[model samples]
Target chain A: MKKIASIIALAVVFGATSASAQTLKTVKDRGILNCGSNGSLAGFGLPDAQGKWAGLDVDFCRAMAAAVFGDDKKVKYVPLSAKDRFTALQSGEVDVLARNTTWTSSRDTQLGLNFAGVNYYDGQGFMVRTALKVKSALELGDASVCVQQGTTTELNLADYFRANKMKLKTVTFATSNEAIKAYDTGRCDAFTTDASGLYAERLRLANAADHIVLPEIISKEPLGPAVRHGDDQWFDVAKWTLNAMINAEELGITSANVAEMAKSDNPDIKRLLGSEGSYGEQLGLSKDWALNIIKLVGNYGESFERNVGAGSPLKIERGLNNLWTKGGLQYAPPVR
Target chain B: MSIDLRAGSPPARVPFYNYPKVRSIAYQVALCAVIAFLVWGAASNAIDNLQKANIASGFGFWDNTAGFDISQSLIPYTNQSTYGRAFWVGLLNTLLVAGIGIVFATIIGFVVGIARLSKNWLVNRAASGYVETIRNIPLLLQLLFWYNAVLKALPDLRDSVKIPGGAFLNNRGLFMPEPIAQTGFGFVLIAIAAGIVGSIGYYIWAKRRQDKTGQQAPVFLVSLGLIVGVPLAVFFAAGLPLTFSYPEAGRFNIRGGIEVVPEFAALLFGLSIYTAAFIAEVVRAGIRAVSHGQTEAAYSLGLRPQPTLRLIVVPQAMRVIIPPLTSQYLNLTKNSTLAVAIGYPDLVQIFTGTVLNQTGQAVEVVAITMAVYLTISLTTSLFMNIYNSRIALVER
Candidate 1:
């Protein structure tokens, strides 16, 4: 009788304990971060020939892993589709969403998601076949436009057409790839999506010169990292990790220069490198936290150049994503 | 104490309740308790999580301004409209697609189903081939094929394939002549209404006269003439007022015409073709359910094959066909949710997806979507149940 009672008691205790523990506690106890990403988008998040995930968004994931575990390799990348990203985060299926998700008011408020920081500034634009002799969106009035459903681009297309008083017809697809296919086969007169997406899509075509993306940016899309809301501690850690990357870049610290700069005489550099103060300890991290991130994923500039900037095939211009010192909008708060 | 009890207790009686039955009831009560506890636990957990997130849990968001635009609204809608109004638009679109699909699918399904059972070798094989091919493939794949492979291959607007009577087909969409109503349109409508009422009255009178006398009334001829003649007379009396406003090919597009967007066309075509295969099978089963004896009996009574089928077989077959047919209609309505997959901006696509994303009320948006779908399913089921009961067999 005593043995049976003890067994029931143990079962009750175990069940109650497991149920009460939060995802944050589990993540900390496990000593690794589970990061969600886009497995196919080239310049945003993609796996290379060596099976190593590399891209601007992938770097943010790596940086967060480094900040948390002091080892960047502790990240397990879970590939997510557009429809599954939010649900994955909400269900604790992933620790962080470093996919190139747009930071929008509805997503932030209604989806119970927290935007970490803006990493890429993007905008919706239209792409048409150059042979059509269409120079601008205005020229394509009454044209059949192919757009992906369940995205901000759909709403933006409607707004643009309504504002311009153009009686355009639209065709919708579940994915951008399908929409591009339809457009390529001459089903739609135009395809509309993010300008960065257009660049990525055009590269996959048989002839790159056949299509041209229009210059009119119909909507603002600030792509960023995201986490589930209601956990302020986790939100701060993710947000500051991105900010540290940008600050490191502005301070002229590359992955190669990170170790040397740790011995710098500058007070701000000393403080950032944990040489002058113990700021890292305040965030429940080691003294070389920022240094570890820079070594593993490099600074923001290095990541951008390697992924979607002038050095890559995407060749996106750093119009608004550049540092404030370079007359762009990317300015981060000082670490001190 | 025992010695005194022996005098009073002469015989022992068994308790009223049996142990086995009591045990069974106890086990059932425990099972019910476990299930209830599980459900209650889940509900409480969800409430706790939602409270922690500070998210409001209700249907209040439906009354807020949608602040979004739908591309193809049958009714007038702007960004300023409430979310509830947007839902109505989506619901209307869903009904429109399902209603049109049912009519077309029924006609095609009945013909094809009969053709499959035909004695003619080529016709039977052809109908069988269509049913087997379409029924095997997934609906989503079929939709993509129609939207991408077939429709996308059309020529550009400048080189649009022009049809007779001022119609144009291009990669964009199909543009055709639209009817422009003149001043006399009201009279034309009234005349059509009058013709409908007159035909109904004539049919009843003809049926009664046939039953009373041994003479046949040409009900078909007289009704057709009344319905057609009245409308034609009104058109002439109203000075032949309807005008065809043919679409003109402008520099960019065909102007002054009714445009049917390619998305809607592709969705409709794909849905109808896919659903018709299932409907055909239902029709074949329903028709086959009618006994062979019924056909033989009709033939022995001097009725021809056509009249035997029209008067005897169809009525009985309808009893078997309707219940399953109602389910198919519900399937079509639910399947319209897949319109979001292709960007048709149906209810699920426009309201639950786009508006939900723009508004950020996950719980509310999902709830409203569930309610809308539930209402549609319930209403359809209710109507069909009433129909089924009316056609049900009555036994003495």
Candidate 2:
């Protein structure tokens, strides 16, 4: 009986190992990254008229594909809701999660996930209609507050109210969009969420000028890309790809200027461009790897501006997300 | 001749064949082995992957400080609180929502169920309509509707719709008068307790007198009078023990009275409405399961319709209602996990989501959450089972 049990265990181990191996090889063979993203978050991840996924998060996925196979277009974007995103990553249904996920300790540790890097700095804030004449969150003590369920915003709102010794009613919806709609329909007195989200939502509203977002930030929300925890190799690749984008922006290597910089005589530039040394080999990729990423997807700044910055309809100010050299929190490690 | 027959029988011994009992044992063993193998393989693979990534795989992370604040906690918590504390807070919130939901749902469900069978056409149709509509939609969707479409539309604080008696309603929540305890409140509470015990004793004596002498005493009237009259008499003797602390409008909020936030109200409303629909079905089926003959027999004994329902029908219906009702309560408890969806900071949102992220103890956090839920579920089942057995029909 013992011998039989051991034999069965061995067979099961072999089966699982082989299955994972098969999936890995298949992903490599396909030469396309299966990326998960938020389907309807406008500035983060959303589809265009051509049914092509586009956003800061979507670009990050494309950049990963570019780094891997030298083609930004070689990505299959799987749109996922907040609930399904982590499960999809754990099941190997997606190569990486580029959805706008907050890097919480539980999700990182318990859910077997590794957040690559902070891509967007967000904090919870409240938005109310101008007609209400409410200035600060303190002014809305007895007001009905609308919030999305299944996110950190709900907890943050409660903390804010309790800290101020203020009492407010909370109206909750499952989706952010629903909450926004409820607020629009005058069901709630105010809608609370991350400031960035408020901007995105306000832009979606029919009358944007009527809503005013409160200045108070109640919670720290660091949204980023994430991957499954078990694979260090994969984790490193995803992490550094994000770092490279940040570094590229700081170094003034825009997509239009990247090809010109690739031929530079400067040793750091050469190394970064994969023209002099073999940094790509260490990461199991070709020379000019990062250059391909820059040329195809542009730097992090470029992605941000196009998707959610001054040029975009959302027109959100890049306060904390700016480069460290420009007085922001986005400082990357030296490329050496 | 007997010796020869025995020798011939020995010569004709049959061949051994497969035994049914042995086959059954083998099958069960194989099934168990398969399950064990799968579980082992999964665990080993997870461990191997975790080791490769250098991530610690244990519950030691639960002791770490959770550098996050929960908005609405029953217990005192801060960024300095341990992950364990956060788990407790979240569990308490979940239980709070579920406990409140079950009570409200039970009241609404029974009322609506009986209303469906009422003689008034309008009342019956409305009750039936509510059951059909709510029962068809998913609970999550209904929760969203109440939180978003319904609650979000409330007016701002400055223009909060004033109800009678200084009460205010807005998006913030409901504000009403709170009773402020004065110096003699303790004495009043003691008197109320004394009144309850005295009433119970009086009721027993009244029942015994009626049983012995065939004179039906007004037990209920006397008990009610004792309970209320005693408390009132004590209250006046203690020089009026409580004062009304009505909420007054402040610069930003209402002052004085306790504030019930909109989140709690919306969650309670959503949970009760959703669960009540299921409970209504359970109640209707229970009422239908009771035989008409029982009602007829009560009527034949010259009992009124109300008495027949109270004494004969409801007692029988309760036996059928109890087991399913227990399940509905369990469902309400589990469904309260959806509080996370609307940001109620129930166990899943605060502990499992925020605290787990801050501490990086996924295994510990999830395990603790699962255990808390399991304990709640098991305890509820144990109590409900006891209640069910008490009400169940005893056969001769």
Candidate 3:
């Protein structure tokens, strides 16, 4: 015991790099991926009646688990609120945080976390009642808007008002539900949040049809999985897992057809599924890592449509989240 | 219990560890050492984690721009203000609500406490019912009820209800006329101040004259007239030089009036009304704890009913009341932290909630907030303790 203790002390004195690089080993020993996700947001990271988690964010974590373990089901989802999301990542409480977290500059640089990739390209938008006769948020000169406090939405709202030289009255609430309730009860002329959040929140209003989300998306909100910054190896695993999903969607691979596509002649397809090279091995995984992800969680397009896209209750379009070939921002580097 | 020691013996000595004083000191040292070790361990662990994760630590984040607008603030705050100014703004707002809530809660508490002991059955029962209902429910729900059920139920901007003082009450808030004191208003303020000084002089003289010759002076009436008449005479003589900025109903909402946002009102109303119930109970217990015989003794000494209650019964009752009253006030101030639930921009809401989220420096932000609350609580209790000593029973 004394010998091991001295060795650990020596290791600490030199550097904690070896000490910090055991995340994958720990997950493998535990046999389950610990994923932090937003527990309350619908069509993004909400649990159903039976405590079954499902969302665009939820699917990304599952995809990560599948890449490493060849089984997406080996994931235990831990729910986190927005304020605690970064803390959860920094404290090593979760292996990967796939909550609907915005990748802001301060958060990426200072919060000891690295955003993997933009799984959901969202923007802040406003939702107003149909009776307000408001067309553009720019028309809301003297309007009182309700928004969740402690969010980037507050900063964005202030910025939008200042840039346009308008007076704004923002009534903030602790939670989105309270914000919606305040907006529903006529306390505010409009409710502002991420556009995806607006759609999800609009569903919980007293009468969803009475409200309309304004077309103005004021600020960009790129949300994705995040890992602690020190472990670039784990960071790569998380980042490339997202890249593989998007690449699989672009290459016409679904969960069902991924196994058959392993025999394809195309070099890119062969390389992506780990049939042509040792790219997966370089990332500290077996050659068939991407193949496992595509097989278990389907491609990014399938996950999106299943959780928050056309097939889901939110019905959000793949506007900013589509592939670069489809004129969207979701471009990934080649597997080679 | 006497055991004999030889005259030649140096005192019969117990080992230093067995001495009560030594034992207590030893125990204290052990406790402190354990606490220090725990703190050092936790801090080292946090520093290690922060370094490994590459997160920044320290108070440097206070200089950064907040980039958020609060709905209401006592001091002027904008997105351009640094986090330090936001901290003061939030602390001031918290003090504002807590100060206002303390005054209102005290006034209502005393009245309801007295009413609970009233001869009228209806008043007594009603006061009891109020205390039972309000304090029984959680303060958060009452805040929500006031915010959602009462305030939000008001008509929207276009159909705002107009009040008599060039004010409007809508779902947004109560918008009232802001008094702009111009050039002549200076004289009015000076006259009022002179009147107050003059009243104090008159009070001393009246008391002295009454004691000397049993000749009563109409001091109350004269002081009231002087205070009001001076302000009024100066106001009219200066041509009533005060303009009001009435809130004008605009296309979307009212513009250009002092606004008591629904958030502040809801939190203040909730804190006062809820805490007043507990204060009422404390007050009742104090008043009841006073002997009833004192009131009869005051009557025998030729004191009237009001004077008897005020001079004799209340003074003794206060000795009991003030201690619990201090605690209630402290609780009310601490309860003001719940303003975070309703977005009141109080210290906890803005500094801890918003600033912590923005900087992600939880340890620094939370420590500062904890220190602020401690300062407020300690200062309040100190003042109360001094006041308590004045009324405390003098026993040798």
Best by TM-score: 3
lDDT of 3 by residue, A198-235 (tens): 99999887789999999999999998889888888888
TM-score of chain B of 3: 0.94
True-contact fraction per candidate equals: 0.29, 0.13, 0.52
Question: Which numbered prediction scores highest in lDDT against the true structure?
Answer: 3
All candidates in order of DockQ, best leading: 3, 1, 2
What C-alpha lDDT do the candidate models reach, one value each? 0.78, 0.77, 0.86
- Candidate 1 global TM-score: 0.88
* Model 1 Cα lDDT, one tens digit per residue, B1-396: 346757776766756455688878988999999999986775566566555554445667778877566656788787668888888887787777777877777788888888888899999999999999998999888877877654657787788899898898886678899988899988888888888898899888888888899577888887787778888898899898888989888755677777776667778888888888888888889999999999999999999999999989988988999988888878877776767656676777666665554554444555576778888889999999998888787767
Model 1's DockQ score: 0.26
Task: Say what the RMSD of model 1 is.
Answer: 7.0
Better of 2 and 3 by lDDT: 3
lDDT of 2 by residue, A1-336 (tens): 112222332332232433233433455687788999988888989999899888999999988888888999999999875544554565456889988788888777666678999999988898988887888878887666777654667667766777887666565554677678767766567888888888888888999999999988888899999987666667777887898899899888999999888877877778778887788877766776788899999999999999999868888888999999889999877566
Count of clashing pairs, candidate 3: 0
- CAPRI-style grade of the A/B interface in model 2: incorrect
For residues A1-336, could you state the per-residue lDDT of candidate 1 as single tens digits? Answer: 112222322232222323222545666798888999988778988898999998888889889988878789888999875645665565566778988788887688766788998999999999888888888888777776887765778778878887898776666665667678778877677888889888988898899899999989899999999987777767878888888889999989889999899988988777777787887877767788888898888899888988999889999989899999998889888888
TM-score of 2: 0.80
lDDT of 2 by residue, B156-211 (tens): 66778998987888765688888889998898788778878988898888879988
